[model samples]
Target: MKKSTLTQDNIWMKEPEEHDFPAAQDYLELLLVPDAAKKIVEDLKKAPTIIKKSKDILRASRLPLLPETNIHVKENLKKVQKNKKLSPILLMRGQNDLIIADGYHRLCCSYYLTEDMDVPCRLV
Candidate 1:
């Protein structure tokens, strides 16, 4: 009987594909310990995914002059304004949320270079 923290509760019961590991499968069939059962659920909760937005963004800085290539700036601005309530100002982050990993210039341009617009951002 193999015992692992991941088998605490029947957490494995909820997620079957996770038992690709031979040891976890063995735990399911032969070894059923109370402590290990609880740990499995905690591990599942910690399993990371594309992280969600953890905080609200701030839009206070001034925008910049529009570039010749930004012909669609006006249209984008209208789209942002139309859905102002539903959409949130996009921001990128590093380890801590709100750390702008990219889009510094583009975001600045959107606000200053063109009319106010909602900008999308991706953080790593």
Candidate 2:
């Protein structure tokens, strides 16, 4: 698909979608025990949203950015072209670096728009 030009503004919903918590829990379960993962997901549900720059998030998380050609990233970029509001990211603080838990694709997609973009997220 041809990509759409994206800006940092109005690209995200004020809060994450309800399904995000479950997805986060699923990912966290891999790194942590199921009980621990569940608790983190619970905490994230109640956590207030905060903004972090795309660059800062990637640096803090120490995660590789998926290329724009990634299927998920490409699909999200298409959503942005249609002005669809994407759910905010869900994150957590791991033992050392930050953990994305969910929304990795969203972060990478936003980075392509501009690393200076402020991404809405709830970090636990």
Candidate 3:
């Protein structure tokens, strides 16, 4: 599929920055073995970007909506408010709930902006 540096909304979605994978690996390592985490990151790199609803992602992941007071959430909100491009979120399917290996803050920020927002993401 063709990948663009933009999404179909005012809240932009671009390809993940270089450091995004490492961050995903670091966070995944906390919940998995080093090799497994490494593998997932690699898979995510090859994964295609697709769109899903912000509320659906939150529901599948079962993560609570972080308050706007959260520092990271605030930062993400600031970026969006300024029309800065946001990286598409990276996701991994766990045995049960989905794992938001990275982009939790951005996801939360989008949720606050619009629960029905179409979140561009790479789900593995």
Q: Which parts of model 2 are misplaced by more than 4 Å? A: 1-9
Please tell me which predicted candidate would have the highest TM-score against the true structure: 2
Candidate 3 Cα errors over 4 Å, as ranges: 1-7
By TM-score, the candidates rank as 2, 3, 1
Q: Which wins on TM-score, candidate 1 or candidate 3?
A: 3
User: What lDDT is reached at residue 6 by model 2?
Assistant: 49
Q: lDDT winner among the candidates? A: 2
Is candidate 1 or 3 superior in lDDT?
3
What tens digits encode model 1's per-residue C-alpha lDDT throughout 1-124?
A: 1122212121111222332223332332343354553344334334432322212232322223455356454444444344321121222232343433223333433444223233333222
TM-score against truth, every candidate: 0.24, 0.93, 0.91
Summed backbone clashes in each candidate are 11, 0, 0
What lDDT score belongs to each candidate, Candidate 1 first?
0.31, 0.89, 0.86
Better of 2 and 3 by lDDT: 2
